[model samples]
Target: MISVKNLYHSYNKDGKYQVKDVSFEVANGEVFGFLGPSGAGKSTALNILTGLLPLQQGEVVVGGYDLKKVSNERFNKIGMSFEQSNVYSKLTAKENLDFYRKLFDVPTLDSHALLKLVGLEGKEHVKAGEFSKGMKHRLTFARSMINNPEMWFLDEPTTGLDPSIAADIKDIIKEKNKEGVTVFLTTHNMFIADELCDRVAFIVDGEIKLIDSPKNLKLQYGDKLVEVEYMEKGEVIKTTLSTVLPEDKRELQKIIEHHDIQTMHTKEATLEEIFIKVTGRGLV
Candidate 1:
């Protein structure tokens, strides 16, 4: 549904690069994530796809239209939500969505229905200015669906919410993908990306460092071993396992047969740990 080749850009045409020789694709009905720390070109790349920023150095084809040649037509097929909440503060939630529904030139989906989809069902008529940060984020999420867009660009979608509220927004993104909407989501939050993105591309200093599914990357880069903690003869025993080795199996067999196993599980890398391994620090 989206394609880019050799993407390169600079905020100042003659200056340092914002994105350099980057390329990736989002398949039809797939959620693709672009992740990086601050100043990592995540937003720069997203802007190029959304037609908000011109691609001065590479080829971009979005929703089957070449970005340079057919932006006017393709713009309608794309939807966008940015880190900053973009809703009109003075308008009620229902009115905010109504305005965008007209702007997109589509028959409006019921406002309350969309509100309900984002967990704001009974608060449709509440003024957005009065809504809390998380609530405003939910309203913006509802507004993005106004056009029933073929593709969506979400940048730092869960920017200003507590854990529970952030999780609620992620759930909505999952639901959107299930309905077959192609999504190009950008964020610095690995935990969020790990949950919602089918595949993620990690970029740093205008270069892509890694691109893969969360599960595959974790398995490939993480330890393939189990660690067992148990008690034997009133003493705590901890054993490190190399799952592929015969000796580890013999040890585990003995533990299963003789000791009381309190906990036994394979060790795996978290997205945060993997990111640090790849780039040396957590997302800023």
Candidate 2:
């Protein structure tokens, strides 16, 4: 659904670039995550794709139209939600979405349904300025779907929301993806990327370090170990045993047979750990 090759962007006219030599593709119905820390050029790349920033160099195509000469019809197939909420403060939640609905030439989703979908049913009549930060964020999310877009560009969609609300947002993204919306998600949150993305690209200092499915990445970089918490005497003991070693496996077998096991699970590398290992820096 989207393709970018050798993408580059610079804030100033200087030779240094914010986004450099970036390239990736998003399948028709895939959730492709662009993962990075602050100032790692995730936003710079996203802005270029969404047309917020002009294309400074390289090639980018969305829905088969080259960004260098893409027409307005192409944008109608795209939707975007930023980390910061961008809504008309004086307008009501319903009004905010209704206003955006008119911007598209294609058929749009119902404002009321979108508002309710994002947990803003009652707030339909409430002014956006009166709503809390979370409320405004939810409103922005609903507004993005106003066009019923095929390509969804989300920037930190659930960044500051509480767990419950974030879960709702994730569910909605999943639902949309099931309905064939191609999502380009930019985030620093490992959990979100691991949960929602079919594949992720790790970007650091404007260059991509790696791109792979979370499961594949974990298997490639994960430690061959199992973590166990079991009752020993009057207290609980927690330990890690190497899965690759015969001695540790035997000891783990003994624990399973004799001790009351409280919990036992494989100790695999998390996405954050893998990112750190690859880039020599944390997501931050």
Candidate 3:
């Protein structure tokens, strides 16, 4: 559904590139994440792909249209939710959606239903200026769906949301993907990427370092060991056994038979840890 090849962009004629020779693809009905910290050029790449930024070099194709030659009608198939709220502060939640529905030339959307879906059902009549940051974020999220777009571009979708609300948004994203909407998510939040993305690209300093499924990346970077916690002499002790160890099976059996096991788990690298290890920089 989306493709980028050797993409590069710079804000100034001689300035350093904001996005440098980055390339990746997102299949139909797939959720692809661009994971990076602020100033990592993830947003720059997204903007270029969405036709917000003029292409400087390379190819970017979305919905079968080249980024360099995309028409205004291309927006009909795309929806975007930015990190900052872009709705009018004076408009009510329902009004905000209503405005976007008309702006997008989408007459089939139910503005009230969209608001309700985002957890602002009763607050539909309240002006957005009075809403909390989380409320504004939810409203913007709902606005993005006003067009019932074929593809979604979400930047920090759950930025200001509480746990419950964030979970709700994530669930909605999953449902959309299941319904065949391709998702391009950009965020520094590894947990969100791990939960929603089918595959993720690690971007730093305007370049993509790696692209792979989270599960695959975990397996590639994680240890092949099992950690066992046991209680002995009123004290808790833990030991790790490499799965490849010559006596691993016998040792595990002995520990199970002689010790009171408290807990056991396999050691695996988290997406955040893997990113740190690969990029040599924190997500911030």
Which candidate number would show the highest TM-score if scored against the true structure?
2
lDDT of 3 at 118: 90
Candidate 3 global CA lDDT score? 0.91
Which tens-of-lDDT digit does each residue in 30-81 have in candidate 1? 9999989999999999998888897798889898988888546565677888
TM-score of each: 0.93, 0.97, 0.96
Question: Residue 153, candidate 1: how far off, in angstroms?
Answer: 1.3
Q: List, residue by residue over 1-284, the lDDT tens digit for candidate 3.
A: 99999998899957689898998989999999999999999999989888888988999899888878859988988999999988899888888887777767545469888888999989989999999999999989998888899989998898868999999999999999999999999999999999999999999999999999999999998768889999889899999988767798689889899999999998877899999999999999
Count of backbone clashes, every candidate in sequence: 0, 0, 0
* Number of backbone clashes in candidate 3: 0
Measured over all alpha carbons after superposition, the RMSD of each candidate to the real structure, in angstroms, is 1.8, 1.1, 1.4
